[model samples]
Target: MPDMPALHALTRSIDSLAPDIVTLSDRIWDFAELKFQEFRSADLLIGALRRNGFTVRQDIAGMKTAFIGEFGEGKPVIAFLGEYDALAGMSQEPDVDYPAEQTPGASGHGCGHNLLGCGSLLAAIALARHLAEHELPGTVRYYGCPGEEGGSGKTFMVRAGAFADVDAALTWHPAPFNGVRSTNNLAVLEYYYRFKGTAAHAANAAHLGRSALDAVELMNVGVNFLREHMPQDCRVHYAITDAGGRAANVVQARAEVLYLVRAPEMSQALALAERVNQVAQGAAMMTGTEVEIVFDTAATNLLPNLALETAIHANLVSLGPVPFDEADLDFARRIQATFTREAIRSSLRLYQIDGDVFSNEKIDGTIPLHLGLRDFEGRSHFRAGSTDVGDVSRVTPTAQCWAPTWAIGTNPHTWQVVAQGRSPGAHKAMIHAAKALATTGLDLITSPDLLSEVRAEWFEKIRQEPYVCPIPDHIQPDVGWG
Candidate 1:
């Protein structure tokens, strides 16, 4: 554990510097950048680190938007991961319900990644400041990880050994609850399936034409039927990206479908994906078409690290939750009105929160670290989404925490959440999260025994299965329309 004085001073420093951090977050939110295109966001973070006396390396992993900032020296090389990407069609004005945008139909930070980057950066800066002041013996690095939304930016970074030498890593996401993530997240694989057939005029040579669209439909039907037999937790989703020729007068010659397979573990996800591929093959055979599959992105399931969870939970408790003001409470109430009572009630119940609404006030106390796999209604658990973070957990000791920054039932990638991302309430949550992360980093640096125990537990939990990338090396990130 970190000394009490050091923890207190760290928290105070974070709180005192809250405005600067909030400004950074707000600027990123205003920029509303997207994956692989976070040029300004990356520059902002990298520039901040440089100004703070940290040496920075840009264009990491052949990605212009990816970079690393480092400070200090010695045993534990702790890296703080940060993201700054927005979602398309989520542009909105701060605190507005309707689609009010400075640039209409533009991308926005609906995922709250603007805050994610700023909070992580602030945490890193705070830790760097502490180490310099106290002469701490450890190295701290900040990774400006881009394209987390769908670009698999970290996959490239991890492949390049960006995180190989780190003793430990820490990350956090803005959410509706504050707790250390100790449960396993689902593994996911994404790919595109293309079918090729011969095109012919429908009326004159329909019999001779093999419709690629037919193959796509058959594949979807096969997978839908397969769902009933697969494990209940397994998930399969797909969308038609191309339907060949648009004119009904001709038989379609080509079609494409994007498929995403997810399961509780990576092995299962891969197995399910293979089964899906078989379905595609069967479809191709039945339709007299040839099929080709191209993998886009694959991510592993989160390997829970109880050791890191415990350390992070301790810091979460020590820093407590974000202190809310009366105005903040009023804002929360207004947002709560947009949701049905039943929905709000269910969300609160899932997280074990009693109130119908959450105020700006700090949480009552520290929440116990949760180890069991659990689901939250209207939040992360109720909705299953894949993230590249899952891959990092499989490779090294990693843990993530979440802090509530929006209305009770606000979902990511929605306009409502995007609106809140630019609000003062969200800013406060970001600051609180930064303090917790910084405090946890300090504990890791000051306590060598804890880090060793964490590493040991991580090893025991994983049992030495080497990490395999879900996205094959041949696949490149496609920035084209999904």
Candidate 2:
């Protein structure tokens, strides 16, 4: 727990700025910009940070929507990662009972990043003020990370030396349940395989036509077959992006398939990607088509910081449950009504959490820490999803927590989570997240020994196995729809 004076100050500061934080979150939610196109979202945040006396650097790492805000000066540069990008095709109106798109097939904050970016910014602003008023010497930074959903914005930033000087980093995610993010996620590799063939009339010259679509299907089949032989944690998925033209009378001359390969480590992920590429080549050769492989993005698996997670967990416990009212529970119950029993059970099984934890139909208190939060001996839960924050973790001692901002059993990138974005419950959790992050950051800033321990562990881990940004230098950010 943080010192009482600092804790009280943090709480008071967050409470004072609660209205602004909610406004920022709601505004971003409304904007629903996708990936690297978050111009308005970035502008809103940058303006707010400048207003709060932060020196804003726009377009860091050559990504337009990616930027960082800095204040104060010192050795211990503590950073709070903020992601504002929304998922494509998930646009939905908040406080709705059913699937109601604000704009059909548009972007939405289904991942709760509207709350994510704003909450971390709130912490950054509060911490900046606290440092100035108390004459503290640490620097506080807020990174306006774009394209977290799939763009690998922070991974590119890591390669650009963005986090080299940071002593530690902190961030949080909006989730259905509150807990420390201890599970290690898979390292992801994304690629687009473009196949070109000879187009011919399907009826008149079918023999002369080389079907690129056939190659795509073969590649997918090869990947699916290889999955059985790969490690249980490894995942390979492909999406047919371009299936030539929509004419049934013409043979497909061009087709595209996007592949996402993931594993527990970067090395493993790369090896798997190599095999997948080989399958693509084989498919191309067999179909007599030319194949062009384009690397889109990649993120390394998260490197966990035990000491930092301990601090975050303690701070989260100290802050206690977010004060939710009966109306919030009522709304949560309504959302819960939409989820089928199998869907709820599937969510429970996926997280390995007991169903009774959400018996109240809402998550107000912190969930119990998982026994397998850390994998000292390669024994931990496998997080199938990927995030650019994993790249930041590679560079410094980083830790993130999940704050409950939606009804239990709500899945990300879905209408359910989007529908709760503007709820009072969501606002309460967002404020609490800011409080937890700010308090934990304050503890790290003040404690030299603790920070040193975290850094030492981070250094030792990196020394044992150095970090190499998975995305190559030549691969630029492709913010288009995957």
Against the true structure, whose TM-score is highest? 2
User: Model 2, 1-482: lDDT tens per residue?
Assistant: 56868988988999998898899889999998988999999999999999999998888888999899999998689999999988878988789779888887787888999999999999999999999999999999999999887789999999999999999999999876665757689999999999999899999899999999989999999888999889899998888999998998888999999999999898999999999999999999999999999999999998888888878777777777778877787787778778776666555555544324343332332221121121122223568888888899989999888877876667887899899988888998889889989998899889988898889988998898798888778887885553
Model 1 alpha-carbon miss at residue 410, Å: 1.5
Alpha-carbon error at 211 in model 2, in Å?
1.0
TM-score of each: 0.90, 0.94
Candidate 2 Cα errors over 4 Å, as ranges: 352-380, 479-482
lDDT of each: 0.79, 0.84
lDDT of 1 by residue, 275-372 (tens): 99999999999999999998887777777677787777777666656776666655665665666656554555555543323422222112211112
Clashing pairs in 1: 324-360, 324-361
